[model samples]
Target: MSYTPPSWSPPGQRPPGPGPRSRRDRGLTALAVGLTLLVVAVTGAGWYGYGPGAGDERTRAADAKESAAPESTAPPSTGAASPRPSLRTPRPVRAPSAQELAAARRPGEAAAWIAADPTDLPRRNIRVDGPWTVGGTVVQALYREVTAYRLSDGAEVWNLTLPTPVCEAPEHAAPDGRIVLALASSGSRRGARCDRFQMVDLRTGKAGWTKELLRDPARDTPAIIVHTAISGDTLAVAEGLGAAAFRVSDGSRLFTVPTENPGRCHPDRVAGGSRLLVSATCALGDDPRTRYSQLRALDPRTGAVRWRHRTPAGRRVERVISVDPVVYTSIDNERLTDDWRIVALGPRGELRRTIDPRPKGFEHCVNVGIGAGLQPCPGVVVGHGLVHVGGTDRAGAYDLATGKLLWGVRAHDGRTLTPVGFRSSRGTVVYESATPSRPGRTFVLGEGGAGKEETLMNHPAAAAEAEYSTMAGRVLQAGGRIVVMPSFVTGEDDRRQPRLVSFAPAPE
Candidate 1:
C-alpha cells in the first residue's frame, strides 16, 4: 500500500484533485458564487426574485406557468363586456301648413272631399256612391245624383241600386269589406206595410239582403228621416209597430219589442250609434192620448230593452248625450204643466242623473223670447274644452267640462253664424265658419278668448243671402287633411259642381 501511494505523485508532482482552471474561469466562478450569496441577501431583504441571473430564473418560471395554462388567442383581460344597444327615436307627426289651410278655406276645395260632399249641397236629390269619410268606401243612396264625372275623379266609387228605391239616404257599412245599406220602401209593398231594411255589398255595386221593417209612414217618411246608426255590425230601426234590430251582416231579424199601443208609438232613434229611444204614445184608440211615455235602449242586435225609463205622461221628447250606453232625454210632459225633465239613463235603462225643470241647475229655465220668428243666432258650437255659442247679436264661451260660464262679446250685426269647425292648436282656438255676413271666414281667438276676435281670410257676402238662401256647409278631417264641404251654387239648383276645400298651417 506504501509503494502504490508513491506512484501518483511521481509524474507531475501534483495530485489529480482539481481540474484545469484558467484565470478568467476562476473569476466567473468567484463572480457566480458571489452573485448567489448576493441573491440570498436580497431575498432576505424582501427584494426576492430580482437579479441578473434571477431574471432568467423568473423568465423560466413564467414560461412554465404560461405552458401550464390552456392556449388561447385572446389576450388576457379582466372580464367580457356586453355590447350596448343603439337607441332609436320616434318620428313626429307633421303639423298643417298655411297654404294647406288656405286651400281648405276655399269653398271649391271642400266639396271635393269624399265625406262632406254628399251632404253639403242644396240639390233636391243626391245619389251618393263612393268611399266617404263617414262610411268609408261604400256605395250609398245620396241625396244628390251620381254622375260619370264623380266616378272618374274617385269621388263615387260604387254603383249601388237598391232592391227597393230607398228614398232616404240609408245608413251603410263596409264591415269585412262588405257594403251594407239600410233601406225603406214607403208604399212599394202591398197594403200600408212599409219594410225598412239593409242592402249589402253596396261597395261592389251589388245588393246583399233586404229585411222588412215596420215604421210609421208619418214620422219616419223619406223627407224627415235623415240617417240611421250602426254599431258592432248591428243596425237599429224604429217602426210604427215598435222598435226592432237586424244583423247588419245578413239583414236577419234578431228580436222585436212591441209597444203597448203598437200603432201610436212613433219611434225615433238617438242621434249617433246603434241605440234607439222609443217615445210610446196612445194614439191608436178613439179618445187618443199620450200613454205613459217611456225611454228604453233597444239592443241593436236583439229587439230587447237593454234599459227602460218612464217619464210623466205627455209627449216623450228624447235628446241623447252619449250614444254608447248612457242616454239623456229632455221630456216636456204636457201632463206635468210642460215641466222639462232631463233624465239620464244607463245602457240597461237605469236612471243615472235626473234633471227636473221645476228646480233649476239640472234643469235650465226655458227662455222663449221670440223677438220675431226664431231668428238664427250663433249656434252652440261644442268641441274640445270650450263650448263656442254665438248668434249675430252676441258670442260667448263656456267650459264644456263643468258648463261654467265664461266671457261674452257681441259678434256681427244682422248675421247668423255657426262654427263649421274648431281647432285648438298652438295655444289658440281657431273657428272655421259659414256666416250670413261673411260666407267664408276663419276667426282666430286668443287662448280662452283673451284677445279680441280676429277674422282671417273673410270672403265677401254672397248674393244668394239677399234672397234668404244659404249654402249648407260642413267640415271634415280625413286623410290627415282638414276638408270643408263644397259651397252650394246660389240661385241655380241645376249647377252641380262640387269641390273639396282644405287647409293646413304654415310649415315651421
Candidate 2:
C-alpha cells in the first residue's frame, strides 16, 4: 500500500526512521529511512531479462472487478423488499487501435501504442501522476483529472478536471505549459492531505489559481506530505510546516515559510531549477545530538535565506540532484551502516564532490517514489558539466568539476543502457536501450562525457514488451515520442499490464 497517502517521508527527515515508500501496493506508508527500491532496469532487462520474450505474450485483459447485482431470495420470501439491483460498470481496458498499433509494428520498430484508461477501477490506489511532455502534448495525472495526450497519435488531447485527489506534481511545466497541481485536501482513499493547489494550462486545459494550503492557520499544520519546485518564475512549496513561494506567472504570493528558524530549522522540501533549494531539519529539542539536516539557499524571490549547507551532525538531505550546480542525495545511518552519497554542490553552497553511486552498480541515488520532489533521479542526468548515471551501469558519468568517475558507456552488445536526457547547444548524452530484441533505441553522447555514441531511434520489435514495462521515471521523450507509462494505477493489474506504451519514428 505505498502510493503513500501520508507515508513518503524517508527521503530526508530521519532522526529515527521511516520515509520514502510507495512503490504502490495501493498507497500510504512512508517517512525517513525506508528507501526500498530495486528497479534493476532503467527500462530494459531484468523483470526477467526483460521478460526476454515471455512466450510472446499478447493476450492481455485485466480491468473488470465488478458487475454484480442479483441476489434477493430472502427479500422475495418477505414478499416486498426485493427491488434493488442496478449495477453495471465494467468495460474499461481496451486501448490498442492506432490501427492495431500500426499492425504490431516491427520494421526497425517505432510505432507502438497504448494510453487509454477510460476510468473504472478504484476502491483504493489511484494517485497516478505524469508523463508530462509539454506543448505538443503528453501530460497525465489521473484521479482528479489532468490528461493531455496527442504526441502525434496517442490522441485524447485535454482533460484537466481536478477538485481533489491529485497529490503533487512539478518536474517540467512552467516553461509556458504552466502546471502546478497538488490537490488532496481530503477525499481519503487512504488518508489524504496534500493541503491544496491548482494552476493549470498544459497548453490550454486552462484553470489558473486555486488555493487551500495554509501559511498560518494559527501556526499551520495541514500539509500531510507535499513537495513541489518550479524555479525561475518561482514556485517552491514544501510541506509539513515550512517553505513556500509562488508567482509562476500569476499565482502571486511569492514568499512565506518563516515562523522562526535559523537553528529551529523547519523547511520541509523544495528544489526548483536554476536554483532555489531548501530541505532544512534542525530536530529542535530532542537532541539525538542536535539532529541536523541543512541545505538551504532560498531567495527564489524573497524567501531569502541564501546559504546554510550544514549536514554533519547526523547527515540527512536525501535526493535533490541538480539545482543549478547543486546536486544532492545524501544519507548516513552511521552504526547501522548504509551510507549512500552523491553531493556535488558549488555555486556558493560549497562541497563540490562526493559521488559514490555504490561503487558503480549505481543505485541512481536511491530511486524514490510517488511524485518524489527535489528531483527524482530516474537514472539521473544533469547537464554536460557532468553527473549522469542511468539505472545501473553501461551508462555512467560524473565529474561536476571533480567528483570524477568520468566515463562508462558500453552497450553495443549489451543493449540495455538508460541515461535519458540532454542534447541542446551540443550538450550531448541522451540514451535509452530497452530490449526484448530488435527495438527500443536512442543514443547520443560525444561532448564532454566523451565522444561517439549516436543512434537516434529504432523502437519497434513490436514495442519491446511495451517498451520494457515502465519506470525510468516512467520514461518520456515528447513529440518525437517514447512514452511508456505507469507512475500509478492500481485496480490490481494483469489485464495484460501495459497501459501507456508509445514509440513513434515510423511516421516520417
Candidate 3:
C-alpha cells in the first residue's frame, strides 16, 4: 500500500467538495493532526520550562536549508573590520655611517638612488604637513609621533612622540639643519584650547624644548600658527595676535611684537634670511578699506627693530614671498581695482620698484587654498635672478635686475599654466598646467626659449593626479629634491591621503 500525506477540512465544511473519503485517507489525516499537536505541546513546554534538546533538530534542518541556497552576486562589503594597528614598540632605525653619508652625497647619485628605491611611509592623519628633509634624513609627523628615516634607504632612524597631536606641520628646516619647529595642541573641552611650541634637533631626533604659547578658554577661535623660521640660535613664530622670537638653545622668550589690531593686521611672514623681516598689516582705523601694510626688519640676535617700511594709503601687501637681499612683496586692493603690483624692497626696507604684472584683458584672480587657509592665486615667484609673474590669462618672466619682461605664455583652450618653481642651478623654470582633457602636465621652460611638457601621471614619483597651486611658500626645494605639498581636500571619504613625494629635477 502507498503511504500518502492527508489534508483535513473543518468540522462544518465538506471534505474537499468531493465524494466520501477512503479509510486510508481518514487514518492519515488523524495521524497528521496528532503529530502537529504533539509538536506544539513540546515546543510550548520547552519555551516555558527547560528542555535540553528541544527544537535542536528543527533548527539544524533550517540551517541546512539556508546553507544550500545560492550565493549572492552583489559585491563584498567594504565595512569589514580592518586589521588592528601593531601595539609593539617600533624597531630602532639604523643610522647611516660616515662612509654611507659620503657616498650618498655624491652629485646626481642621491636623487637617482632615491628615485629607483622610493620610500613610502604610511600616515594616519592627513591634516598635518608632509615629509621634510633635514640633512640626509626625512622627518615626518605621524599620528602623535614624529619619525625620522634615512633618505637613501628608508630605514627608521629615530622617533619621538608628541605630548599631544600636532596642530600644524613642521616648518622648513634651516639651511644649516639645526632645529625643526612645529605647533601642537591638546584636545580641548568647552572653549579652552591649549597650544604649545615644540622644537626638535635635526641630527639626533631629540626634542629640544616645548613652550606654552597660547591658552584661551573664552575664545572659541583656533590658534593660528602663521609662520615658523629658524636662524642661528633664534627661532621666530608669527601668530594672529602677534609675533615672537625665541632662543633655540633653551625655550626662552626673546622679544614679542603685538600687532596693532589683531583682527585687521595679521602676520604675513617671518623671513629669517639675511635679516628677520616680520611683516604685518596695520589698519589706519576701524575701516578695513583704509588698511596699509608694514614691514619691520628685526635683529635675529635681539628683538630690536632694524627698520620699518609702511606702504602708502589704500594699498595692502598681500604676501612677502622672498627675502634674499631683495624683499619681494605682492600688493593689491581688490575693492578699488582688479590689478596686482609686485613691489620689490631693498634690504633697508626701502621701496625699490613696483611692476604691474597683469594680463591685458584678464577679469579677476581667484583665491586658492593652501595649507590651512586661502590666499589669492596668480601671484609672483622670485627666484633664479628672475621674477615670474602669473595671472589669470597669462604668465611672464621678468629680469630681476632690470624688471623687463623676458618671455610670456598665454592660456590656450581654457588651459592655464602657472610657474611652480625655478631650478636656478639648472637654469630651467617649471610650470604646472591645468587642462581638462588630460591629466596635469609639467612644462619646463629652458633658457633657450624652448618649452617641454610632460604629463605628471607619467612621472615615476609623482602622485596619481597631481596638481600645483600659486601659493607663495607651498613648494620646498632642498637637497636636490623638489617637495610639493598640495592643498588638502575636504569631506570624509574624498580627502586625499597626505603624502610627500620627492622627485629628481628634470634634466636641463
Candidate 4:
C-alpha cells in the first residue's frame, strides 16, 4: 500500500469538494490538494522538492498499519525481532560539468553562442537548490531562491540568494544580464508597507539598489509596484498609483509618470527604445464606482505621455507590454467570453495593428498560474521576428511582422517556458511540463513548434514529494541555451539539495 497524506488545503478553508468523495475523485483531489501542500515547501534545493512533514506522514501512516498486523514467531525461535532488509537509498542527480559542456561547443556562435549548429543538441546540467522567484521581485524567504543554468546542454551554473525569508517574485531579467528586478513584501503587520522593489546584480547576486514603494492614500488600498521591464540600461517600475523609471546601472531616478486619477497601473515593458507601455486599470470616479482599463505608452526618458489606447472599461488590461513590438493580452468579463489580442505600437505610440484571437473563450485563465496572460501568455516568447505562447491546452507560434498565427500544438500544463537563454543555432522555444505525479519534463520547441517536442530529462532522483509547492520559472541567456529553476517543496534541513538546470543546444 502507498502512503498518501490528506490533501493540502488553505488555512481554515476546506478542500474544493464537499464531504466524503468517490474513489475516482480521491486521486485527482489528492493531486490537487498535494499541489498546494507541496507548493509551500517545494524549493530548488531546500527540501528535495518535498516539505519537511512529507515523509513523516508516510512513516506515521505506515507505522499505524504495521501495528495492526498479526505477529507470529517461528516455533522455538529466540525472543528477538527479525533483522530488516537493506534499504536501497535513492541516488542523487548529477549535473553536467563545465569542462564536459565546453568540449561540445561550436565556432562563431553569435551572442552567447545562440546561433544554430544542430550537430550538438540537448546538453544539460541539472542541479537542485533553494527556491527563487522570477518576474515580480526576488525575496529572501528560506525557500525563495533561483537556479541559473546554461541553455546549450542544461548545465547548472549560478544561483541567487534572497535578501530575507520572504520572496518578491521576478517578472523578467535584463537583456544585458547586468541587473534583475523583483517584487517583495516588507511583512508589516499594520500593512503599513508590504510590497518592495529591489535591483540586484545579474552575475554576482549583489544588491544594486532597493526602494520602498507606496501608493496614493486617497483611494483604494495602498500597494507597492510589482512588475518591471528593462530597456537599455533603464528599469521601469509599475504600480496602481503610477509608474517610474530608474537607471539600471546606478538606480538613479530617471523620470516619473503620475496617474490621471488614483487608479491601478503596472509597468510591463519598454517598447522599442523611447516609449514605455503599462497596463492601467483604475476607477472612472470615486462616486458610483466605475472602472476603466487601457494600454498607456509613455516616454521613459522624460515621462511624457505618448498615447493611450482605450478598451472596455470593465475588462482590465492585464499586461500592456510584450516581448514583440506590440503588446498582447487576453480579457474575460462576466458578460463576454475570454479573448486574446495583440496591439502593435509605433515609436510615437501609434496603433499599428490589432490581432485578436477573438471569442476563443479559452477555458484557462491567466490567474491559474504565472505568466498566464492572453497576451504573451505563459511560455510564449517573442524574438526579432516571431512570438511563441504555450498553455496546457494549446501552444501557438506567430509571425510578429504580420500578426499571423504560424503554427500551434497541444501540450500539458507548464509553469514556465521561454526561448533558450539568449541565442544559439536554431530558433528554439524551450518549455517545461510540470505535473502532480511526474518529474516535470523539459522540451525544445523549435521553429514552428517543430523539432523534438517531448524529450525526457531523466532527472536523477524522485522528488521528495509528488507536488511542487513554489512556482517554477525560466530565463533565456545569450547562447541559444536554456536556464530553469525547478519547483521546490521541501524544508530547509533536508539532505537532498535543490538547484537550477541549464541545457545548451548542440552545435549545427
Off by over 4 Å in 1: 1-140, 143-165, 170-207, 211-227, 260-279, 282-292, 318-321, 325-410, 413-432, 435-437, 442-447, 450-470, 473-508
TM-score of 1: 0.50
The residue-by-residue lDDT of candidate 3 on 116-180, one tens digit each, is 11223222222334456777877766435676666554456887777755545324455555564
lDDT of 1 by residue, 1-508 (tens): 0111111122222232223453433444465345434422432111111012211222233223323434444342222111111112112112223233334433322222122233243322222222244334322244223221132123445444344434332233434444344343432322222344555554355556665454334544321222344555665554322345566678766766575444554453423243444444334232213444555566555656666566545434444444444434343322221334434454466665553323111111111111101111113334455544433323444444444445544332223233434545312233344322233344555343435556543432221121111122333333333334322221123333233333333232
**TM-score, prediction 2:** 0.33
Clashes of each: 41, 27, 1, 100
- 1-508 per-residue lDDT for model 4 (tens digits): 0111122122333322223432323443355345434433343211111122212322233233323434323231222112211112322222324453244323321111111111111112111222233332221222334433334433334555554322323344455455544433432212322344566655455566665443334543434323456656766765433567777777777887665543343232233233356655455332212454566666666767767765544554545435336555534322221334555555554556655532221222222222211222334555666655544334455565676665544432332233332133334444443332232334545444434354423221122121121123323333333333432222222213234444333335
Index of the highest-TM-score prediction? 3
State the C-alpha lDDT per candidate.
0.36, 0.57, 0.45, 0.39
Q: Who is ahead in lDDT, 2 or 4?
A: 2
Comparison by lDDT, 1 against 3, better one:
3
TM-score of each: 0.50, 0.33, 0.60, 0.54
lDDT of 3: 0.45
